[model samples]
Target chain A: MTVKSKHVRIKGIKDGLVFLLDDKCPFEDLLSELRYKLEHSHQNILTGPIVHVDIKLGSRIVTEEDKEAVLEILKSQGNLLIRSIDALEAPGSKENDEALFLMSGMLRSGQVLHHQGNLLFLGDVNPGGTITCSGDIYILGALRGMAHAGVEGNEEAIIAASLLSPTQLRIADIISRPPDEWGTRESSMEFAYLTNGAMQIDKIHNIVKLRQGLNVFKGV
Target chain B: MGEAIVVTSGKGGVGKTTTTANIGTALALQGKKVCLVDTDIGLRNLDVVMGLENRIIYDLVDVAEGRCRLNQALVKDKRFDELYMLPAAQTKDKTSVTPEQVRDIILELKKEYEYILIDCPAGIEHGFRNAISGADKAIVVTTPEHAAVRDADRIIGLLEQSHVESPKLVVNRIRPGLVKSGDMLDIEDILQVLNIDLIGIVPDDELVIKAANSGEPTVMNPDSAAAIAYRNIARRILGDAVPLMQLDRKPGAFSKLKKFFGMG
Candidate 1:
C-alpha cells in the first residue's frame, strides 16, 4: 500500500536544505516524495548544493523504519546531514566540519546523542541516556549515565566529565565502571581512556602530561 | 481537544488493563468525555474488565475494516454517561487494524472528547505499536520486579526511538511490606533503572480483582487503595501536584490488643 500524493516542500537553508512535509502524510511517503523531488529538481543527485535535509514533521508521529529510510537517503549524499526533530524546530544549518556540538539542556533519561565529531554537554546525562561519538565526549555536568566514544573503533577517544560517575563508560573496545568504593562525591573533572589494556580515569588537567609520560614510558 | 493516552506494559499480567479501566473511570468522573479503546484484538479483556462486554456490538477490528462506523463500535459505560469503551475483536487478530487507521480514529476523536485512554496489548509487537500510534502521550505500566523493569527499559528505549517524548511511568502492584522486608524491588530501584518520571504507584490490592470482576473500576470506590492511587494519577495527568499516599499496613494483634485495652 504505497500512499503517495504527499506534498514536500524543499528549500535552501543556511546549513542545508529543509524539507517541510504535510503533517498528515506517512513518513515513508514523505521520504519517497523527497527522493522524487531531489531526482526531478536537481536532475543529478551528485551535483546538488544541498548539504543537509532538515525534516519538519510538525506534530506527526514517524515510524522507526521511516526514520531509517530518511537516514539512508541522506547517507547516500555522502556529506548530507540529518538531525533530530528537535534540531529542525529552529530551522537553520551550518557547515559540516570537525567542530564541537554543545547541548546546553538536560539530557533526560532515554535520550541519545549519536555524532561523528566531538560532543560537549553542559548538563546531566541522566541514567538510561547515552552519548555515542567518534571523537571525544566532554560533559561539563554530571555524567551519571552511559557514554561511548570511538564508536567507529578509534582507540584514541576519551570521555571526560565534571562529575565522572557513569553507569557504564566505553572507549573503543574497553568498557568499565567506577570502582565499588566510589560513591557520590564532590564534582571534579576526570578523563577516561583505555590505559594499560583497561579503562582508567585520571584528573583531566593531568591528561596531556600523562599522554606525554606514556610516550616516554614506551620509549624506555 | 482530547488527547489519546495509551497505557501499555510490554510484559503480560502487569496491570495494563487495570490501569486503563481505573484511569478511564477517574477521567470520566472528572466530567471529561473519555473513551477507553481496547486494542488487544483476539485476547480482549478490557470489555470484560470494564463490564461492557454485553454491549459491544462492533469491535475495533470491525471499525478499522469499515464494517461499522466509529460510534457503532463504542460501548457506552453503565456507570458514567461520559465514559465509553471501544472493545477489541475476539475472533480477529491484531493485524486487522493498522497504525494508520488508529491514527485516523484518534484524530477524529480529538475533536469531540476530552480524553482517549487506549488499553494496549502485551508485548512490543504490532498490537503495541498500533495502540501507541495515535496517542499524544503514553503511560508505561510496569510492576516493581526485575523482569518487568527490564521490559519497561526496553519499551522506554523503543518509545524514544519512535519519538514519543516524555512517556511517563506508572509502577503498579507494589507491595510495601515486601519492599520494607527487602524481598521485593523498591520504587527507587525501578526508577534508577528505568530513569523515567514516576507518575503513580498502585499498591497490590486484592480489591483490584474484585473490582475488575464486577466491571466497576476500583477508582469508583474511594475506600479502595488501588482506586485512590488511580484517581491521584488521573489528577496528576491534569497537572495536579498531589502528594503520594502512604500504603497502610494491616495492624498486628499487639496493636489491636493495645487499643482494646486502652493502654498507652
Candidate 2:
C-alpha cells in the first residue's frame, strides 16, 4: 500500500530526485515515515543506476544530530545517493526563518536562488547571478553578482562573502551605493549590513562583534 | 565514432557562426573530415559565411524530412574537399526541425565526418535546443563584453541542465588595446564569470569582416590573426595543447629593427 502521509514525499526535478519533508511534522514521525518508505517501496523508486536525492527541510530547524539521523536513514537504503540537504521557503512565515539552507555550486548568470531562512552558498556567484535570502546570507566563495539579505524585511540580517565585489547588495529594503561607486574588485573577505537604513561594508573579522546574536545562530 | 561539437552563444553578434565556419575550415585544413550543420533554420547564414551558399542543393529540413539523402543536402566546401556544410532551411522556422531529428542527423553524420560542428542560433529557444541536442561536447563562443559573458554564463547553465558535459569557452572579438585601457572586459574577467576552460581567444580583426563579406572564412586567409586563433581552436579540439595566440597589439620596442632585419 502507498504511504498516504505527506510527511515524506519523493519528488522529481530536471536533473534527479528530491525528497521533500513536511516542516510541521515531528522529526521522529518524518524519520519513521521515511524509513518505512525506504524499507518497503524503495524498490519502485530506487531501481537501475544510483539515484541522487536532495533532501529539503522546509523552514524546519534540524540540529546536527537530526541531520545525522536523517542521513543515516537515507543511507540505509542501498540505491540512494544523498546529493544535498537544504531548506526552502516554508508555506508561510508563521514561525521565524530558523532553518539554514545550504547549497554548493556556482550561481551563473540569469540564475536567482531564493531561500526563506538563513543561507550558506559554498561557491561563486557570477555577474548577473542573484541570491535572495530572508535571513543572513554567507558565501564561502566569491560574490560578484547581486545579493539581497532579509528579503522579508529583516533589517538585522547581514550578507557576508569571502570576496565581496557584488554588482549590488541589499539588506532588508536598503540598497547599496551604485555599483560604480563601489570601485574595483577587492579579494579580501567582507560583510555588508544596514546601519540606520544605509548599507555599510565592513571587514568580515568584526561580523561577530557587530552582531552578537550571530554566535547563537551559527551553531544552527 | 566522431564527436559532435555545437558552437553556441546565447547572445547575437558574439561570433557563433563565424566561430563555426572558421573552426570547421581549420579542422579541414588539418586533413580531418569535418561537417558544419547550421541549426539557425529560418535565418540560415552559416552557408553564406562558408562561401557554399550557391552550392546548397538541399537543406537540413530536406534531409530531416526524408526528402533527400544526407549527402545530397551536404554542400562541399570549395576550399577543402574534406569539409562540408549542411545549410539550414531559410523558409522554415526552428520548429520545422525537432531535437530528435537533429540528434538523428548528427548521429548519421558522425559515421562519415571526423568532426561535426553544429552552429547554434542566438537566443535560447527551440533553435538553441535543437543545436545542442546531439552534441557530445560544446563550444560556447562569446565576446569580451559584460552582456556577452553574462549570456554565455546562462548558456553554460542551460548546457549543464541538458546533460551536455563541460562546454569549452572561446572568447571572440577581443581587443587587447581596449582591455588594457580598461574600456572593455579582459579575458580574466570573462573567464571568472564563465568558469569554463578557455579553448581560444580571437582578436577583433578587420580581416574577419572582409573574409565574411567575401563569403570566405578567416581560417582560409592564413595571414589573419583570427585565422591563427581559429586554427589553434581546431588543434585544441583535436586534443593538442596549443597556447593561446599573442593578442597584445602593443608593438614591441624591437618591432622596427625586427621588421628591418626580416625577423618574424
- Model 2 per-residue lDDT tens digits across residues B160-249: 888687999999998888998999999988887788999999999888999999998988876677888999999999989899887664
lDDT of 2 by residue, A1-220 (tens): 4566879888888878899989898888899889888888666877667888899988897777788899999888777889999964343453556767789998988889998899999999988899999899999998989999999889999999998888889999988854565555555888888888878777887788787766545453
TM-score each candidate: 0.65, 0.75
Docking class of 2: medium
- How large is the interface RMSD of each prediction? 4.2, 0.8
What range of 10 consecutive residues in model 1 chain B has the weakest lDDT sum?
B252-261
Could you tell me the lDDT of residue A170 within candidate 1?
A: 90
lDDT of 1 by residue, B1-264 (tens): 888898987889999998999999998888889999898999999988888888889988888889999998889999999988888999988888899998888788888789999888988899988988998888999998877876777687777667456789999999888999999999887876677798899998888998999988889877677888999999998899998877645565456436434573
